[model samples]
Target chain A: MMKVVKRTYMGLIFLFLYAPIAVLIAFSFNSSKSRSQWGGFTFDWYLDMIGDRQIREALTFTIVIALLSTLISTLAGTVSAIGIHYMGRGVRTAVLNVNNLPVLNPDIITGVALMTLFISSGLPLGAVAMLIAHVVFSTPYVILSVLPKLRQMNRYTAEAAMDLGATPAMALRKVILPEISPGIISGALMAFTMSIDDFVISFFTAGTDATNLSILIYSMAKRGVKPSINALSTVMFVTVVILLFIINRKSEKGEELML
Target chain B: MRMLAWPYVAWMGLFVIIPLVLVLLYSFTSGDIHDMTTWRFTLDNFARFNEPIYIKVMADSFLLAVASTLICLVLGYPVAMIIARADLRYRNLLLMFFLVPIWMNFLLRTYAWMSLLSPNGLINRLLLSVGLPKLEIMPGQGAVLLGMVYNFLPFMVLPIYSVLSKIDRHLLEAASDLGANRFLTFWKVIFPLSIPGVISGITMVFMPAVSTFVISALLGGGKTPLIGDLIEQQFMSDRNWHFGSSLSIILMAVILLSMAVMSRIDANQPVEGRRAA
Candidate 1:
């Protein structure tokens, strides 16, 4: 009896969670423009979404920003994580706490704070400002991800390499880099995901110069329902599911390598 | 190796520290941020926020956030308990389902609720078809609260579930041996043990819900405004950076104060059940 009740309750919660998503996916294929009424199924909205110039621009911006931010943050974060790992405890804790500021603060505050910085510094709000903001927020996550892997590592291995014939640079490249590569990969993935999905921060910093998919969607959603948005949501949702599944499978085999 | 951290430390100071300092600088001064000579230190911005209308925005933001956090706790605790008690083989899969919605764009998830709750939308259409009166929740506090609960439910669930699943079965067995019934065992043993998770869950949900402008803008239909909206207006529309910075400071203070209080409560909990064997 208890098991039955539990199952039913879980089922209802799942239903509530997925109902909106189901409605979105189903309506993406609806031939009629109306969001409420169901019409005959069609792939026209997807095709329309594909053909839309504004959306195409937004998609391009989103991908470029995500890729760039992930690449830069991953490099900077990994290097800094190594540095912090070797630091004296007192300075390390202070820097780590500072690093947590962006992570801990609300997005709105971060957005406005960065906006004020950019404006005060005389940097115009646009793609560059947005890119900078992304890097600022994303690098801390990379540091967090990489720091743990660094801790788990045998610290003496690199010193052993250095004490032998290996140069310091070579020891870093050949020994330390490979050991923390898993953390780097996962951190890159996280940075990419966050950059792509960010709306509130991007909304503030993107100005009128650049529009990511998220910013575009917000604008469209504000104006009213658009079938193209429904189609876009369906595509993005499927992509996320597939990507997460692949990541999950890889991490399961590797063990504690992904966040 | 520590030398390599300097660049990033410098970068953080420029981007993270300096910006926050500028917010503080702007909040206490009312003039162009660009021109130092134009700056005049004053508390007028915060003083302006002392008005009743603005206070109501803060109060409403708090009330709504609290309400949503409470709802999420009530709904999510049972789900967490069920999942924690499930077979190990099925546990990850169930947790994955709960988290999938969260990976979707936050805006898109909120947008999904917008479509569902709108007048001619799914819920009302279903209600009309069933010969029931239309449920007019959209463009109101109800819709905004629903959006908050929906988007943040996973945060509440994940933490509690982690703590619950890690709880030692031996503790429950010991309780039962002591002549405690299941209900009594849960109240005395399980609930107290889960306080840390519950506290973190509350912080996670409450912080986002209180500070979000998106849900209030979309679902509240501009009829309701939270502290986030007021701050957004100052920065984005009104171009009143002074007032915006003040509001952001208050929001940060509220979050920090609550977090401090939560940690105090967490620290005060009995230490026995907190540790898992």
Candidate 2:
């Protein structure tokens, strides 16, 4: 009786989890784009997505920003994590807590405040402003992800490298980086996905012509619900699933790389 | 690591502190953009509190956030339990389900809902065809809550899942052997152990929902202006930074107070996990 109840509960939970995405995937493929009559199965939307010029551009921009933001923020967050990881536990915790302030603060605060600062400083909202805002948002997450690994690692290995006459930089490069590489990679992935996924903050910070995929989607929505966006969604959805599959497989292989 | 210290100091100062100080200053000083730098610190920005509308919006935003948090917690708890306790084979896929939506572009997900829920959209159309009541759901408070809940569900899930993975199964077995039934065993053994996750998830949902702009803007159909929407409009369109700053300051106070209350509750409960204590 208990087993039955537990199974039913778990089934309901899975249903809740997958229902929306299932609905989305189904609708994207539905032949009747007018409403969702399911007239027939059609791959026409996915084919149309291939030629959607604005969507292509938006995706290109989104990927570019994601990569750029991830790379820079990874560099910064890794540095911060290593720095705090080495500090006395008390001081490290304090600095780490302060670094997490951005997460606790609302995005409106971050968005409007950053926009105000940049505009006030006469800094045009271009690549620089958007990248800065992305980095700001991404850094804390990377730190949060990596800091646990830093905390858990046996530090004596790095100490041994240092005592064996390697410089601190060399020890980090030769030993520490290899050990913590998984955390760093996952952190970078988190940063990349998050930057691309970001909408509100990016919309506020981005100006004139420098819109990411998210903003492009919003702009499209404001204009009208184009059936083409369904095509675009189908494309993005497919790519995301493929990407998730690849990442999981890679992680499974433990493809550890330094830098 | 020592070398890293300098750059972090530089990074935090340039990006975090200066921007934060500027916002703080804006909150205190006069509101007009023309005299932004000059200060005759006035409470007038905060004085806008006399209007009941602003307060109403704040309360509504808070209520929506709280309700969403509650729903996510109740729903996420069991899903997280299964993900944590499942056979190792499908664990990755189940976890991927949680991560995929979160990692997917937020605008796409929100807009996808727009298409799904619109008056002439798929959902409404389906209901009409099935001879059910043709319900309007794409606009207003209901729509905003839907978007907020959809977007926020993962935030609640991730934290709870992380916590669940660390819970000891032996504890549950022990509770059952002590003569507690399955429900009582779960209630006494599992629930208390996961309070930290619940607290963190609450913070995650409440913080974002309290200030969600894009979801509210897209789904509210201009019927409601959330605190986030109001602050955003005040700064950009209204060009009333003074008023915006004051609103921001008040909102910040509310957020801090909410967090304080959450932490106090967390502290009051005797922590079951070593780390939580």
Candidate 3:
């Protein structure tokens, strides 16, 4: 009886989570334009998604921005994590607190603050502003991901490399880098996911010309979503599931990495 | 290694510190966008909250956030406990199930609810087929609350599960050995240990729910605007940056205060769950 109860509860929760997704996936093949009626199955929405120019542009921008921000933030965050690891306690504490601001603050505050900053600095709000906002928000998570690894490893490993007649850069590249590579990779993936999924910040920072898929979706949602959106989400959902499956498979400590 | 830290320092200063300071500056200033040169500092933006409408929205935001957090706690605790106690082979798969929806675009997820709850939506159709009335819940607070719970329940569950799974089995055994019933063991031994996870979960859910503009916009249909929508409207539609910044500052302060409280609870007893990221 207890086992049955548990199974039923789990089933219901899983249904709650997936029903929307199933609806989305099912609707992607929806032959009818109206959401209410399933006018037989058709691949037209998928084909239409392929042919939609605006969606294609938004898709390109989304991937490009996600890639760029992830690359930049990962490098900055990992390097900083190393640097902070070696810092005197006082300065390191202050810097870490500063780093925590974006992570801790609500996304709207971060979005609005960055938007205000972009305006004050006279930077035109567009892809560049959006990219900078992504980097600012993302780098902290990367730092956090890398910091624990740095704290766990022996501080002497990199120094040992230096003592063994290797140059500082060589020591870092071969020794320190390899040690924290898992953190770096997870951090990069996290940053990429965040950038791709971001909407509030992107909405504020992205100006007229340089909008991503999220911004595009928001606008389309406001004006009644196109069936193409269902197609788009279906593709995105599949992509993310595959990516997460691979990541989970690769990492034994997947739960902590996710945290 | 120490020298390598300078770029990070510089980046944080330029990007993180200065932008927040800019928000502070803007919150205290007044003027049109074009006439930034003559901007004068004033407390009027902060004072604007005295208006009944803004106060109502702010209260509504908190109310909704609290309600959703409570609901998530009620709903997620059992699920988390069940998953934690489940056989090891199925644990990862169960966790993965909860996580996959979060990976989908948040907007898309909310949009999914929109389709389900619309008058002509699937749920309504089901209701009509069952000889019941169509649900008018879509464009109301109930729908918004549902959306909030759906989106953030994972945030609540994951932390609690992480902590619960790590609970010392010996303690539970001891409680049962001491003649405590199953409920008593849970209450005395298990529940106390899960407080940290619960605290973090509350923070995770409440923080996002209180500040979400998208969910309220889509699910609430602009009929019920949360503090987030007010902030968004001020900046985006109304072009009132001063007011927006002030509201942002207020929201930030409230969220930070709650976090401080969580940290205090966490400090009193060191938590095994994920810390605030």
Candidate 4:
């Protein structure tokens, strides 16, 4: 009886949280202009999304930028995490602070700072700048995600490997990598999601020729909200929600949670 | 090792550190919009920002952020507590609902909110159909506050849950055995001990609330401009880098000052000094 009541309460809380989003998605296919009528389900909006040139370009650009940024940041972050492990207490703390500064800083401030850096670096404000800025901001997340797990892994394992005459590369590739594989995978995903979902930072860095999905959506909303945006958002939301569930399920099977 | 470290240090200094220093310097300088790059040292921008508009906006941002933070606290604390107390079998499900939203595209989230809150959208339509007065939600500060709270709630919850879940249940049982009721024991024992989680939640929510731009822009509808919108306009449309830099300097000052205050509060919190209080 107690468990049933608590479960019902949990259901209600989730309903409150998700009802608005669920309703919006349902209303997208409504035949009327107003959101009142639930006329019928139709594929018109989803069909339109595939044909729309702006969304196609924006979605492609956003994914490409996210992928590149995640790849680079994972490399830098893993290295930084490794280096941080070897440092003394004060130095390690300072480096960790510098790494985590991006998390505490405001999006708008980072955006402006990146813009300044690009202009000063004489790099044109476009895809390259966005990629660089995304990596710079996201590397800290990758570091935080992976480092504690690295610390948790038995240090003796690595020392034993070194004593067995393995090179740093060999030990990292063979022994350390397998132990912290979970962290690396999750860190990569975190960086990927963060880069892909970001609008503010990408907006500041991408001057032209590189508009991301968020920018496209924002511009369309500025003009006016449309049923098509609702359609696109519904699809995106479902994809992410399902993906998150799958990831969590795998971790529950003793794979390890996203670090 | 030093050589390897040199590259990263140089990279961070040139891009992150130097520009912030430049922002401070530029805030003290005066120049025309036409030639903002070439600065003449003066305190004019800071002086001009002493106008009521900038001052009021900063205060409004604080009020809005604080209100949302408080709501997140009330709403999130119960949820975090329940999750912490839940069986391991059910805890992950609760956590997923709280966290999966953070993974979805934020633009999509904002756009979804825009549709819900628009004039002809579900909220107003529902009101009209039910014979209730249509609430004007789009133009006001309330909508932005709601949007910020919704988007940032997980940030608040995660930190609190992280602390709460690790707490030993025996502590609660000991308090209960002493003849304390659930609510009273929570007040006397649980709440006091969870100060660390509370402070962590505060910083997690407060920092993001003060700086978020998309929700403010999407929900604010280009009117009732916050410092975020103003800074964006200065950098892009206004093309006045010096003034923009000055605004950034002031904004950074506000954030750093708040963090300082939060740290002090965290230090003097009851859990830190008196163990059994």
Candidate 5:
């Protein structure tokens, strides 16, 4: 009886969570444009979504900005994590507190602050501004992700490599880099996710000419129902599920090997 | 390595520090952002915010955020407990269900709710089919609150689940061994230990709920305007940077004040638990 109750409770919560998504996926294939009624299945929405130029541009911008920000932040964050790891306690603490500002503050504050900065500084609020904003918010996350691995690392590994006649630069390249590669990869993944998933910050910074997928969605959502958005959601949801499944499988295998 | 950090430090200073300073500067001065000569130091922006309508928005934002956080706690706690106590093989799978929705774009997720709750949308259709009255919740505080809970439920559950799962089994055993019933064991042993997670979860849910314009904008149907909407308007439409900056400052103060209170509560918990034990 207790087990049954627990299962039912879990089922209800999952239902609440998935009901909207299920409705969305179902509506994407509906031949009817009305949201409330389904009039047989069709693939027209998917085709329409693909044919839409604005959505295509938004998708392109989303992926490109995500890629660029992830690359820049990962490189800068990994280096800074190394630097921060070697800093004196006082400076490290202060820098870390500063780093947490973007992470801790509300997204709107960060968005508005950056928007204020760009406007005041005479910087054009477009793709470049959006890229800069993405990097600013994402780099701290990478630093946070990489810093843990740096702490876990054996401090003397690089020094030992140096003692064996390796130059400081060579030791860093061969020893420290490889040791923290996992952190770097995960940090890069995080930065990419953050950049891609961002809406509030992007909304403020993207300006008139640059609209990412999220900005496009927000505007469309506000204007009322769009069947194309439902289609887009289905595609993105499926893609995310597949990616997460692969990641989960790989991580499970890693655990098995460790065991 | 220290030298390697300079570039990032410069970036942060330029992007993070300077922007915030600019906001602070704007909050205190009325000006054209492009031209410095027109800038005049004044408290008029904040004084404008002293109006009753602005205060009501702040109060409503606070109330709605608190309500959402409370709802999340009530609904999420059991979900967390169940997941934590689940068999090891299923734990990750169950947790993944919670995370997948979050990984979906937040706006899309809220938009999903909009379709479900709209007057002519799925829920009303279902209700009509069932010979029931239509449930009209969209474009209102109810919808906004629902959106907040739906979106933030995972934030509440994940933290509590992590804390609950890490709790020492031996402690529960000892509680049961000491003439305590299952309920008492949970109350005395498990609940107290999970307070930190609860505090963090509350902070996580409340902060975003209070500051989000998207959920309220999309789900609230322009009827329910939170402080976020006001801030967005000030910046995006009103083009009143001074008033916006002042609103942002107040929002920051509210968040910081709440966090300080939460941390104080968190700090005091262990001692109280020890005494009770």
Candidate 6:
């Protein structure tokens, strides 16, 4: 009886979580334009998604921003984490507390803060400002992920390398970097996901010419979302599933190495 | 390594520190948009909350946020416990299921609910087909509360599951050996141990729920306006930067106060990994 109850409860929650997503995917194949009724099954919306110019442009911006932000923030955050790991206790705490603000504060506040900064600094609110905002929010995640790995490392590995003939830079490159590579990779992946998934900050910072998929979706939602959005979301869902599958396999291999 | 850190220090100073300071500056001054010459430092923007309507909005946001957090805790605790105690074969897969929805664009997911809850949407159609009355819950407070629970459920579940799965089984056995029943064991042993996760989850769910404009706008219709909506309106619609910044500061203060409360509850345990809000 207890087992039955647990299974039933799980099923109900699962239904609650996935029903809307299922409706969305079903509507993507829907021949009708109306979201409420399914006329029939068709692939026209998927094809239309490709042909839609605004969507194509938004998709381009989304991908480009996610990639650039991931790359830049990962590099910067990894370096900062290493530096932070070596700092004196007080300075490290203060810096980390500051770093945690963007992560801890509500996204809306962060968005407004960045918006204020750009307007006051005279930076035009376009691709540059949007990218800056993405980097600002994303780098902290990278730092958060990377710092844990840094703490777990064998502190003597880099020191041992330096004790030999290697210079400090060379020791860092040859020893510490490899040890913390997992954290860097995970941080980069998270940064990419955040950059892609972000809406609020992007909504505030993006200018007329520079819009990502989230911003595009928000505008469409207000005016009523189109069937093409269903198609877009389906594609995004599939991509994430495949990406997670690949990452899962790689992490399993990492576990095997540890064992 | 220290040299490598310099760039991040510079980046944080420019992007993180200065931007927040700018919000503070904007919050304290008036005539921000109108007159460049007659800038006056004022607290009227903060004082605006004294109005009954604004107070109601803040109160409503708080009540709804609290309700959602409580609902999440109730629903999430059992699910987390089940997953934690489930067979090893299914554990990661189940955890992935909870997390995957979070990976989807948050706006898209909320939009999905918007359509699903509309008068003639899929859910209503299903109800009608089954000879049941259609729910008129959309575009109201109930719908808003449901949206909050749905979106933030995983936030509650993940943290509790992390803590639950890590708990030493011997403690539960020892409780049983001491003649305590299952319910007693749970209350005395498992529940107390899970407080850190509970605290973290509550803050995680509460912070976002209180500040969310998108969920409220889409699900609650225009009837319910959260602090987030007020802030957005100030910037986007009203073009009142001073008022918006003041509201933002107030929102920050509330969240910080809650964080302080959470830290006081579990002074020793650091919220890390997936629990790192």
lDDT value, candidate 2, whole model: 0.79
DockQ, per model, reads 0.81, 0.51, 0.79, 0.47, 0.86, 0.76
Model 6 per-residue lDDT tens digits across residues B9-29: 888899888888877877888
Per-prediction TM-score, chain B alone: 0.97, 0.93, 0.94, 0.93, 0.96, 0.92
Deviation (Å) of A76 in candidate 3: 1.1
The model with the greater TM-score, 3 or 5, is 5
Candidate 6 residue-wise lDDT, A177-227, digit = tens: 899998999999889989998999998898677989998898898789889
Highest DockQ model number: 5
Q: CAPRI verdict on model 1? A: high
Per-residue CA lDDT of model 3 for A141-254, tens digit only, reads 999999999988888878898898999999889988888898999999899989999999999899788889888888887789999999999999999899888877776476
Candidate 5 ranges beyond 4 A from true positions: A256-259, B271-277
Reference-based TM-score of each model: 0.97, 0.90, 0.95, 0.92, 0.98, 0.95
lDDT string for model 4 (A54-172, tens) is 88888889889888989988887777677777677787788777776677788888888778767765799999888888988888888888888888999888889989999877888
DockQ class, candidate 2: medium
Evaluated on chain B only, candidate 3 has a TM-score of 0.94
User: lDDT by residue for model 4 over B38-149, one digit each (tens)?
Assistant: 7688877877778998888778777888999998898788778888888787788778876766666776676677777878777888899899998777866878988888
Per-residue lDDT for B185-208 in model 3, tens only?
Answer: 988678888888899899999999
- Which CAPRI quality tier does the interface of model 3 achieve? medium
lDDT of 2 by residue, A1-259 (tens): 8568767876776564455566667766767766445667887777767787777887888888899999998988988889878888777777777788777788888887788888878899867898999999899988888888987889899899989999988988998888888889989988987887787788878887787878888887766655667767666777888987897888756633321
Worst 10 residues of 5 chain B by lDDT: B268-277
lDDT (CA) for every model shown?
0.92, 0.79, 0.90, 0.78, 0.92, 0.89
Q: How close to the true structure is residue B225 of candidate 3, measured as C-alpha lDDT?
A: 96
Model 6, DockQ value?
0.76
| lDDT tens digits, residue span A1-259, model 5 | 9899999999999999999999989999999998879899999999999999999999999999999999999999999999999999999999999999999999999999999999888899999999999999999999998999999999999889989999999999999999899899999999999999999999999889999999999999999767999999999999999999999999887877886
Clashing pairs in 6: none
Clash pairs detected, candidate 1: none
Per-residue lDDT tens digits of candidate 1, residues B61-167? Answer: 99999999999999999999999999866777788888998878888888988989899998999999999999898899999999999999998998999899989
